[model samples]
Target: MSKKETKIYKNVWKPGTEDAAKKFGFIRPEDIIRKNVQKKPTSKIDQILTGWGNYVKSHFVELSPELKAESQKRLEICDPCNMRDRGTCSTGRQGAHVVTGKLMKGCGCRLAAKALSPGSVCPLGKW
Candidate 1:
């Protein structure tokens, strides 16, 4: 095979895990293994309030053309991000600060609604 025809495969799971399971006569089911295992106490009230406020403003208030353009730009950034999962942001995956060069994670927000909110900010500082 030529260099141009070569393919590389990413090792996504633990080495020999599937083989070990098979040795034990078990069939492994396919699923997304989340890296963020330690659950933290997030402020439910604050999250709810922010989500509600964004919804109301985006749906009820008229957005200027510039604001709409900005929203679209934000969505474009979110579309191909690995941190996005099932139309929502996935937390705990490593990202970087746009300005400070600091490590960060997703904020766990619905992308469609968040993209429309003028006050909503990307956890990765993409916008």
Candidate 2:
């Protein structure tokens, strides 16, 4: 994909930002047109269920300043990720009603809270 494709995420991009295109290569059509293809949301109900299970496995894992710091480190990466949307992953693959495989929305978790919790992990391993 091109910088042009970032627009789908509401980012502003110039077609021929000479310096940036030169640096990123993919931004230049001459380099790669099919670059940066959006990935398939691969998390299945089993994964979401697994994520939730981790949440339970780590039960009683209380919050500490360190955990907050750890979660922040993860969220920082998430903020700029392509699949991130409204604090959820685009690959909430099983859909919103995913527990039953009946929706097309983002990952249902409130990322800030969940990422901070020991009970959860990013389905995409981004964090």
Candidate 3:
């Protein structure tokens, strides 16, 4: 008997509350996807975070000290390794979400974790 292929359902992160957006820096998945479609990122996490900060700084008012502190704390706790299970090695497989139609692979951030609030930043671009 041959094993049948199992179907995987696409998992979508929905914002649970308005406060969740504030906690997670509130960037829409659509926006992220649009940016991704325009240009592929070839930088590492640190650089990406730096660029993100710069972009946010340019647009929004300077982050409050409290917000900055919180952001730093979250950044520190972010471990891309435990988010996904890809085998013995957890480094390469960061925030990979296997959904039914949409597939997000090689994403690294808390956005991939269930711990993140529904609307928490999705490290992966929109599907």
Candidate 4:
């Protein structure tokens, strides 16, 4: 066959993996093979709180806390949430952003402000 014709034939008739396995001894890797990478488990609170801010914004009307006691309770829960930072949350997992020269959080809300809002409900039901 001409060089071009031989090349085209070879391309068209390339062996399938299964066929190659039979011809040249192949072994699939074992399914249970372990890798060396170690990773930490995600916080349960953080996972639970995901997407909660958006849900609250749509379903609840923001209100100023009627009782200092109520705000304090909410703040206690938020203070340790995995998604929460100094005052912001990992809403989009980016932590925080500055808008109008003021900082806002990933969840599109700040925990301190949101916790104090009378009508706001905790997405994860912590408060």
Candidate 5:
């Protein structure tokens, strides 16, 4: 009896995925594939509470000029980050600070409020 060999397929992209990705202006077809990569789930309740707390602290409370400056610096770093989608840190996205190469996780917080809050820390450790 001979042992059978199993063929393993790699880089198996789904049908029409590349086309749809192109239609949406994705620069690389691989970017679409990367989005489907599974990541460990972050706590939604924790994210929600943290976001709310930061929002309240940043908005209702007074911040020093130093804190405001710090927020500006953080925003500058976040502006070009791949994990930042719209205004929020995109949860479960991979990659890191584009320049620094540190590993990243999405905290699911609004960047503006999160930066302004004195106690808030970045999921990517940018700040």
Candidate 6:
């Protein structure tokens, strides 16, 4: 066969039977044998929280205990208010708030702010 014809035939007849097996939950003995391999357990929530914490830490400075407490209070108050008024702060307009420029501006998280602020006793780092 000509190269072009052969290429076309190969493309059209490419093997996709494994995909059908996957759809039907049919596993080859080799695959079953491989299943005995040890695998680490993954933590979905830990992964997500770790990613979020890292992102927050990268942006802000570490915080102090007092500041952390205040931020936590602010977050607690902000949560209900946000839920009532669409996921934002009510007073400062700085925490996912939609009204002011300061919206989404503050750490608003006790642990996060504590970890991101400069001179913070939080043990994380400066913002």
Prediction RMSDs, each to the true structure: 18.1, 15.4, 19.4, 16.4, 18.4, 17.5
Say which candidate scores most in TM-score. 1
**Candidate 1 residue spans exceeding 4 A from truth:** 1-63
lDDT of 3 by residue, 1-127 (tens): 1122111111122434534543454545675577469865445554456545543573666745664554455444443434445322234644444333454454444232322122233344322
Q: For candidate 4, write residues 4-76 as lDDT tens digits.
A: 7556545544435445543433322331132123434545444335335433653575534454467678778
Q: Which window of ten consecutive residues has the lowest lDDT sum in model 5?
A: 1-10
| lDDT at position 104, candidate 3 | 44
Per-residue lDDT of model 2, residues 41-125, tens digit only: 4455544565455456556665467766777788897787656778877654432332444445445675665665554555555
Candidate 3: regions farther than 4 A off: 1-55, 58-61, 79-91, 94-127
Question: lDDT for model 4, on a 0 to 1 scale?
Answer: 0.51
What are the models' TM-scores?
A: 0.50, 0.38, 0.25, 0.36, 0.47, 0.22
Model 2 pairs in collision: 1-35, 1-36, 55-119
- Superposed model 4: Cα runs more than 4 Å off: 1-66, 94-106
Model 6 over residues 28-69: C-alpha lDDT tens digits? 457646655654453544444653564375558564567555
Q: Assess candidate 5 and give its lDDT.
A: 0.67
Candidate 2 vs candidate 4, lDDT winner: 2
Count of steric clashes across candidates, in order: 0, 3, 6, 3, 0, 11
Q: What lDDT does the true structure give each of the candidates?
A: 0.67, 0.56, 0.41, 0.51, 0.67, 0.42
Worst 10 residues of 3 by lDDT: 1-10
Candidate 5, residues 1-127, lDDT tens digits: the string is 1122111111222455555435544435465566667544546555556556756776778756787788789999989988899998888697665467877678878888777665667776767
Worst 10 residues of 1 by lDDT: 4-13
TM-score of 6: 0.22
Screening candidate 5 with a backbone cut-off below 3 angstroms (N, C-alpha, C), the clashing residue pairs are none
